[model samples]
Target: MTDRVLSGCRIIIVEDDYYQAHDCKQMLQQAGAKVVAVTAIVPDLPDLLAEGRIDAALIDINLGHSHTFDFARELQARSIPFAFLTGYDAGMLPDDLATNVCISKPADLHRVVSVIAGLASRGG
Candidate 1:
């Protein structure tokens, strides 16, 4: 196991896949993050954010049938840093969100944890 580099971060995960979400949750937990919320739907995001402090987010670009650009906008507006985990290329993302981090699906677990940790450490 690695060091607890993400010890103080609180994260929200918005992936629609059951296995992927659970796997990601385990990875973050192992990295010492408190996964405040994990859901396959987008509607819960606003409520989750309103419920408590969230240091960062790992979002899947597609939530089964819906897209995530609008939700990402809200996260951006709230100053909560997030990165997309998608199978698609960067060109597939909305233009406004083009600059945000885009980690490919089947993500590198270490990279995912490290990116979120970096965002929290930077106070983003």
Candidate 2:
């Protein structure tokens, strides 16, 4: 990945684990993007989107007892690119969402950063 592939990009992080969220935020910022928010809860997605600029996102599949498929749908409809970072098998994702990318947990930070950078750079 380039040093500034994500420059000026605004990213949202939907992750339940505090440490993972924080680390992802730090890595993305280091890659030159602004992390708009790192949220565990999914309520008021519209309000969340309205709060600031968002170009892409990295989401965990499971949060508490709920899955983030609905949130993914919303982002899809808005033409915002996102990737699921989950420990679960990608087969668990719904067929409608099967086309979207899924990154397994215990991720390579370089790869994660590069993928998000590609998404933001290409308007994916």
Candidate 3:
């Protein structure tokens, strides 16, 4: 286990997998982050964003039958740092998202914490 490196960071999880989301929430909380919301649908994100105070986001590339590319763009526009938590490789992503941070599924929780902590610190 890692230290409470994400202390005071507020985050959102955009993943459809119930077990993955639950595990991630627990891990993030243990690392000292406040998980503001967890949603499987992109359309629901606006309301979550409207509530404000999100430091970063951990988003899955594929959600049910759809993908989160456009949602990722919106997050970029809002200047909220985010990382893709996907089973796909970076080369599989679109050109625009290829440069963004990406963490594969079955990820190392400690490493995920470190990445989120860094993103939160950057604040965009």
Give TM per candidate: 0.93, 0.92, 0.93
Q: Worst ten-residue run, lDDT, model 2?
A: 41-50
In candidate 3, where is summed lDDT lowest over 10 consecutive residues? 43-52
Question: What is the TM-score of candidate 1?
Answer: 0.93
Clashes of each: 0, 0, 0
**TM-score result, candidate 3:** 0.93
Model with the higher lDDT, candidate 1 or 3: 3
lDDT agreement of model 2 with the native: 0.86
Query: Sort by lDDT, best first: what order?
Result: 3, 1, 2
lDDT of each: 0.87, 0.86, 0.88
Which candidate should be chosen as best, given lDDT against the real structure? Answer: 3
Per-residue CA lDDT of candidate 1, range 23-124, in tens?
Answer: 889999999999998888885566786788889999999886889999999988988899998888989988899999899988888899888888888767
lDDT at residue 2 of model 2 (Cα atoms): 46
